[model samples]
Target: MPGPDLKRILARATSDDDVALSETYVWDLASLFSYSPSASQAFALSFTRRFGRTKSWRVAVKCLHLLHRLLRTLPSDHPFHSHLLRSHANAIISLNPCHFRCTSDELTIFVRSYALFLDEALFCLQVTKDPSLPPPETFAKKVEEVDQAVELVSQLQGLLDRAMDCRPLATAGRSSIVRSAMKHIIRDSFMWYATLWPRLMLVLDNLFQMPHRLCIAGLDIYTSAAEQAGRLEEYYDWCKRMSLCGPYEYPLVEKIPQIQVRAMESLVENMWQLTDSSSSSSPVTFSSSPSTLTVSESGSSNCVETLKNAAINVEWEKFEEEEKPLIQFGQECADWEDLLEASVDCSWTWAPLIFDEPKERSQNNGDNGLRKHEANLQEYNPFLDHAHPHAM
Candidate 1:
């Protein structure tokens, strides 16, 4: 049984009015019960967490959608939204921890992470619309972060899904929330594809490559093997690969016309934005109120360390590396690194499991960029490879 103090903590965290604080409190509660499985189970089933995860999945689903909603409300220059993303990413990743030898059933976590990656991309697009973000050049760097995440996701899908008949998110099949999430993913993905493609083309050279050009699943637009395939065919093929992407069915044959019009319209609108960029002398501006975690203050290192080691905590630096590019897009974006320099702030902690290959080889058949990444990682870089004494 929980004491009065525990009840107080739980009450504060579950409040919808103060969501940012809820992150910290829930994390605290999660850690408090980790060592006590009975307590953890009991607490999880307390009609709150259990219902959030099982009966309705709204709370667990909020783990994705609510964050997206919150991010959409924030200005791109606001530092806290990114922090929330990192924290949310870490929490989601922890839910699906994977060891190399783990069975196929354990791949759910990996799949969830992939869906989150797309969510992050959507958030970036939403925020970057703020005139305050950096220039397009720096914005282009965000593509790398997305690509890297995809590489990791593809690896998980490939090796595990190879031998198993796992329906992408079969673990949560009973939950309608997952189904709704899939629809959101498709809607947002088309928006993302529509928005980013023109921006990349205008600033980047033709010689430069985007892992799959405009495709998120690394589907090859030009494949010798599928000589008869056209744009619609290519789109449907890539959509098929993102099968576990969310809880929805693949938007295929029956849905082709609807998707075609949406995607084409989105592309045209982005093209207009691209043309408008050069002519605009002023861009609209906005800002977000800071959250407690991103308030640019520090507590005791011991307390910080405990939080860092807590299952919910993520590394500040690695997350910074991944997120810096998104904020880098325009000249007016916020300075995240300087604002939270005192502490690592927060890092996007990923699952420990690393895959040697994507769930399935891409139509490109070049291993996308993972092979080169693996090779480059083998070479030591004093800057990136070394741990900071402060972090230690």
Candidate 2:
């Protein structure tokens, strides 16, 4: 039921030809959505029908790009988002079984997985639409809210995984449309996956505070995050494989440090054991002496008796069996320093995170103002050399 202009745009947008979806066309659709309520609804219906019958991966991917842009560019209260959500909820444009009648197995895999990614994007829209769902920053406050946030984050991670699976074959990777789609996938992956990784870590951190809640059913949280972080690394690798990295342009996107996750796992494991030990402790206490030590004694003699009782309770057999004391201050200091360095290096920060020195130069040198300011500061401080003994 689309008007002639709307049909023409949709036809061009979802053509079988190997062309990238036009941003202008997408914006045109957005402009039409804003034209009037009836116009938006009509375009939604027409696009849904066209998208449902999509038989080509090119057409399918283009359609997803259009829908993705619409969902992304439009306001949260836009009727189009609600319309698509209602359509999917009613099974009008379901993507569960993407039967894109493609002949190539690679194309089939790409289409099906990309279809699932789009489905998750819709779910993300639905989550955002609901005012009741807690924001990620505060979602860890309650068990129920944490569950909701975890479910949402998990779905976003699945979307990232599916996007990874939608990688193009060598031949297809050269296609303009395929490359364009991969670029969009890169943006979405960075925006959703990168953002969600930190949020998941925050959830784990907050949950860790309540040992009772964590011990009850939260063990999987750590393993799941570690696994998802691995997938995220794979995604970064995929980006590199796609040649998305460039010196002035496509710097490798930052990711959560794996060391942070390992450190968290270590803490969680120790906490789990501590909680278990506390819960399973017995009521009986070890007695210091058989007869010499009594509950009550004079002040001076009490201290002597306490020392005597402590000496009596000592496992003299174990001490006699060992050749030296069990304390090693040197190794302990080394371990402490290692832990401190890791914490300082990888503590979660909202600003741009760069781990490698090569990229660190880019971050530092990219800002002309910062470089000039540093130069000025060095001029003011004569002993500003890093290797100088008097350097601060």
Candidate 3:
């Protein structure tokens, strides 16, 4: 059983009241985890049970927030992280069954979105530390590093989107808990924004070193990041409207550098020019003293033109229009003697010894009378199959 303090704090933290979680409770929970090994186990069991029993989105969001705070405040080497990792591995704290409900549809949507963001946060805390790109060295190595950075940046952008989706709509009330959660999300968004810029620049710097196809792909990645960056102001304004940001101003969104765009465009143009020049040049002729082989450009062009201009009608067979043959199985009747001859007995040789005989019980014996009553009750009531026979 969990200690009284643990139970009280958990109840208060996950209550339906519209209030922000107290910082004191967070520290208290951390202390409980550090206090004893059994405390952590108790917390896990009680937490899992409470989360499993809740249907309201508010309670679910509060529970996630509480868990998130603990994971953030705890030290890296704390036993709590290891315990959580094991619980997650064993599916003791699963998010698969999280279905939060609310009277307001908009609030429900926001809760679900916030829940998803918290889910990602917990995964990052437990599974992976910060994964950075390797230092750029060789051409192949540099390109590979840039590719990895590009993928990470893309993932960060997606996480940002998920965080941004945790918004209380205009129709919804600005609950303190919601604002509190948004404050954390806003800070996280800023950190991601800061990380995003460097990765985007890294991709841009190495864009030209990639192969022609990868060069285009890298450019596309940069464009996507730029577009997402452009939406930072909208997100900030949303936070301001929700009153989540008080006295603090969000950083200005950076404009995409024109020079980088021009460089990409110029590289693409040069590649296309080289391709056109090669294609327009005279056809090569190969020769040997014994025999000479030559390719005629005009003849090849004419052949291509003929193939493009020629039209041949094709008719396809419609299998759906034809009737498929139905399979018919022959039903052969066999006599009992024949079946018995072919059948091998799979029953145990001592089956008759284990089988119980239906014997009459005397009412004079208490145990026999109880057994007879149970047999009669079970026979008449099919629903009692799962009920304890002795309960009656």
Candidate 4:
């Protein structure tokens, strides 16, 4: 059980009136418990209420901070753990053109935070011990809830799609909101795909192994919803804009194109093979291959080959393009190679923790006792340091 001091800190942390609690208080409260079902529920409710009422970008940021902190203390089996998870799923549903106040910065924060939360939750659930505590049935229920949320997101996305297809709205904020909302929807969709891809693949594998065929119409709900919402073109435009933003920018920009290319290639190959096998024994055969057959076969092969060649060409062209001289441009237009390099290198300095072994166990038994003692001493040292600056 946590001490009374911890309860006090948590009360202050969750209070709407004091949004600027100290970082130390936040960290201490988070470390006190391995999991807290009630705390998780309280945090979710507070975040939803605050976020719903505020148009402030700061509110979104604060909500994200609180969410991240709450999630840090929640284990998958905790009663209210799913509540926080569902809140995120619900966010996608609620991020509609009507509900979302679309500032670029705010939308970016929301999408990023949403993605991070889902990623962290999935990771914790997948990697934690005692996975049976949540049970498969409970997980299935959670997934169904997520599915409903996805439907809502698709509906919201459709609105943005319609707005983008039509002429710009007469109102000042309306068109901008629609465009920004569209970006957010596309981003959310991509994040959904990223988060669900592994689980979907596992389901597909199970279906392939089972005696009975799997009916996956429910899986296509997102697609149908997007089509109904009128956002297919908007989705495409969003992807195009993301690609044009840079050559190799953003966390998963490279991944999106790669996944699409691989999926398209696989579909084309499978269809072509099926067609070829069917045509080989057909009664009616033309001297040339059927037009549909030829188009499908040739188009698939040609497109893939062309794309591969283009990738090689682009690599060579990048070097040449970087060397070309240009007329004097403003400071804002200056090349940021140095800045980019510095940032990338800085990331590498922490590679041990980020890229090293995912888990490690301490081998020194002697050190464990010492570590415990040190922790106890540190815990009480805060009080001892009240009268001495150096003691702190």
- Candidate with maximal lDDT: 3
Question: TM-score for model 1?
Answer: 0.28
Residue 83, model 4: lDDT of: 60
Per-residue CA lDDT of candidate 1, range 264-371, in tens?
233223222344343332221212112122111122123223223321222333355566443344567457775566235645456578667664665456775778
Clashes of each: 19, 0, 0, 1
lDDT of 3: 0.64
Q: What's the lDDT for residue 271 in model 2?
A: 42
Q: Select the stronger candidate by TM-score from 2 and 4.
A: 2
Query: What are the models' TM-scores?
Result: 0.28, 0.59, 0.59, 0.30
**Candidate 4 stretches greater than 4 Å from native:** 1-26, 31-37, 40-56, 83-392
**Quick one: how many clashes does candidate 1 have?**
19
Each prediction's whole-model lDDT (CA): 0.38, 0.63, 0.64, 0.41
After the best TM-score superposition of candidate 1, give how far the Cα of residue 134 lies from its true spot, in angstroms. 16
Lowest lDDT 10-mer window, candidate 1?
288-297
Residue pairs in collision within model 3: none
